[model samples]
Target: MKSERLELSTNDVKLADQILESMPGFSEKMLQITQRLLNRERQHGRYIVRDQLARGGMGVIYTVYDQDLRRTTAMKVLPPQILHQEPKVSSFIEESRITAQLEHPNIVPIHEIGVIEGSSLPYYTMKLIDGEPLTNVIRMVAREDPDYVRHYTRHRLLDIFLKVCNAVAYAHSHGVIHRDIKPENIMVGKFGEVLLMDWGLAKYVDADDNTAFEEAQDSSQIIEHNPSRTEDGVIKGSLAYIAPEQVLGEPSAIDKKTDIFLLGGTLYQIFTHLPPYEGENMIDVLQRAERCQYEVPSKRNPRAQIPKAVERIILHAMAPTKDKRYASCQDLIDDVEAFLAGRRSGGIRQFRVGQEIIKAGDKSKETFVIISGKAKIHRSVNGRNMTIAEIGAGEIVGEMAGIGQGARTATVTATEDTETLIITYELMLDELRKLPPWMEKIVFSLADRVRINSGYLHPLLLENRIFPLVNQLFLIYAGAHVQAEPDTPISYPLKDVVNEVTMNLGLDMASTTKVIDILAEEGLCVNVAEQLSIPSLQDFALFNDYCRCKMDINTGVKKIKEIQLTKEKDSCFRQIVRHLHEIDV
Candidate 1:
């Protein structure tokens, strides 16, 4: 005996739906029955549904067998109840079309797209990937499973991130933006194949396609239910990882940077074992997303030992504003690859004593970090060079000029043999661009202040004005030391010298120390082990006379004195006075 398949006509199905709607449970049961009858009737174009593989907000993925092609495949289809809804139908069809257009290896290939026979429901068959979603792998790693912990090292996770970047980059090249990028949508195959799944929220920027799903306003719709996946006609993306613009519901803000933000969020989860945003519920998470409020990856999970370079990349990509984010996936890829390769954009420079590291009025956009030794910052005022500040190892210089993007405001010279890291403007801009808009504005303002303050009275003049007290203190101590030899340095306890200067001149220890440091820099005094040593009392006396001469010239006090000295002493004194006279004090 031959079996007969029962089929319902279009009107009969509609009448049954209306009748079932009158009863509560009957509607779902009847719809399932009708779906089964339709499947048995036409068998969905020779593809038999085997078992449900996966399900997402948009559709259900089933393990289907192709009778004609004689192979197993994955078929994504919408629930039969939502078939008549136009927005859902349009979104589903667009997703199929977009996925079919992107033919990258990391992106699942669409094998066939067709409507089910005897109905308007649509489905698409894709290559069946033998893999689990990245969400599963992340969970396993988070639990610290012995196998996962040993296998999924930081390097391995980064490799997965790079593969995803390649796919996103390829898609972006074709003018497609994956607005729903996250770990849940990333499928990691058992054999190291990483595929970016679900192009359902992808936007076709090259075309004016308005069929894209709208953003959700209600947080309740997205909570506690696949919070990692985006839904159609509700939330455009997962609340935990969506960009601020996505949470703001501005479709115009969606661009390449938006996808970069999502990629950053995914990378954050890889190391920190938590999404960038977290709260008690979806509303709290959405608020955090809107405000871009989240602890940095380093503070979020210190044990992860997140590399500083990788953390910078994440912060750059997930910048609060889209303008601050990487402009393209390729730009992000370059940074990630650079970090992985242990490369830096900064160059190393070695400067000998008295070599100029930076010259004022020069148009250069490089900032220097002192790696060893010390340098002096000086600026020219009225054709006279004045020392502005002293910078030693582990200090940064020229950043103000770099941030201001203008001519160098001051000159920097190595006082001793020095090494520095020269950071180019391009690299500085790359990192500075990641700052929040307000913070960036503040940084620019500070740079401007530094540049403008060069015209004011310098602090070196104040140090010079207090130079007389140090001279008097030295003279007092030198006279009292009757045991001092002719060429030997006269030593005095540093505290005693500071106290003597402060007691007589009403000066603080810091002021006295500044004067002492100036004398030390000029080689007149040597400081060691809480003791001040004058290398030569003759040289010290000569420098004191030079200070008096400079001060008298500024104060309009005409005083002349005749002095005689040896050739070596005269030469040394003249050289020191010449440098000091450049300050015009």
Candidate 2:
């Protein structure tokens, strides 16, 4: 069998393109064959355009194979259909240059910028992310897909939001403002990579530019419900998420704060499953955005269970007046990070007397900050609910479970009508994650000691035993290796480590050695071959923090009787006024 290969010369390829263009009403089958052949023959420098991935207002994107690098990447090419348009070409070039300059993990990296050898089709290749737009994820969440709901938890969304914030902060630091930030422009990769896409509408802080072709320049092809297309004098961003200043169409009004507003809108959609601004028509939507009129996420979607701290952050970032909003992305990041860390001053709740605030053995993680009134701690000691201690305003309860220490160790019931602020489990975990490795082990150690027995050692001896010992142990572990990997253990001399801890705490070696055994039992450290080895430095650090917290609770419970009360009069007054209003008095 003779296999013969037929190759076309330059003239044959040119003639085929001419015939395909000139032929009128060609059969669909023949057209498909001809197009496939033409596409195979076409090459953009080292890239062979395989198929059109998407068609956007500015240009078309194609899945391209790079012959030089022997890899697949996405190529955005300014379509020949609009090559004659000067503004479109300029915007395309600007987008490539700007995106290339901003080297960040969260921003798509541009690899090569060039033009097709025989045509004026300018293109740029970028890393092809194996992901879907955040808008798609938001849709799945909106429809309540079980898997999506479980995977895209509020905490996960906030994590993604923070990454986008970092990208925006980087852009701002480089004196660039992303004028068109929306869910559509965010890509959530398969392996938890969050990327902020589309920078065509980005502008330099000092430039005065009218974006008549801004939306067209954006790489997102998904036409939103009502994209605010810019004319000679009109808005230049997605209508639903643009800042109020964007609605004014003043070039000077668009700045870093505008990006903050867009971020708030994205976050609002994340929690509420809908954009902040909505109306019956485009005009109405524009009017709402212009006035910054929108319900807080909870009000917009009660079932979303949006947290109070998150709502405050959204409102503060989306304030109608620029001056009222967060001054910078870093400021916005601080508030959001604080909320995630469970450092928020939560909303107040009133509990009736005799109400059980926490039940022993229950796996709950809410920590209650006492605002007013008193609570009694009770533990079931040998099948009897024995009163352990009394707590008043300025105290906290349920912290053991809050720090991921498993089940509640005791029961708490209000001795009198009580007021409290609650920290949720999710926020508690977020806060716990931020703890330094050393602090984490301290906490775990203290928690284990308390769990071992509320009255393990004499209170005086226990105080001296845990704190100084744990602190000294941490200093040795951290000082040994600053950058040790979690899975790899760090070894220190057992005798020396023990001597250091006991001498610092002024405690006997036997008591301090017992503490190390407990930590080992808790899977925090290992004692082997006369060496003190911390299997996971991170885990050891977590235990350290847990021990410290338990110490505070133990000592604080003892001194509750001696503490003086300083009431918040304004809070009481506000409650009274609210009660009167409810009763119409």
Query: Against the true structure, what is each candidate's TM-score?
Result: 0.53, 0.55
Off by over 4 Å in 2: 1-44, 212-225, 228-234, 346-585
Best prediction by lDDT: 1
Q: What local distance difference test score does each model get?
A: 0.78, 0.75
Top TM-score: which candidate number?
Answer: 2
lDDT of 1 at 503: 73
Candidate 2: Cα lDDT at 472: 66
Clash count list over all predictions:
1, 25
**Tens-digit lDDT string for candidate 2 (1-585):** 999998889999898788877876565668678756555444445677788878766778889888756789999989788799897799899989999999999999999898888888898889898889888898998898878877786768889999999999999999999888888889999899999988878889898787622333332333333543322124568887888888777787788999999999998988888888767666678788888888878889987667667888899889999999999999999988877766664467888999999988898778899989999886655343455568999999987777656678778999899999997876665555345435656886787766666534333342234545655677788877677664556887878877887666555676567667665654557878878887766645654554455445444332222222235533432343233223210
For model 2, the run of ten residues with the poorest summed lDDT: 557-566
What RMSD does each model have against the real structure? 17.9, 21.9
Give model 2's TM-score versus the native structure: 0.55
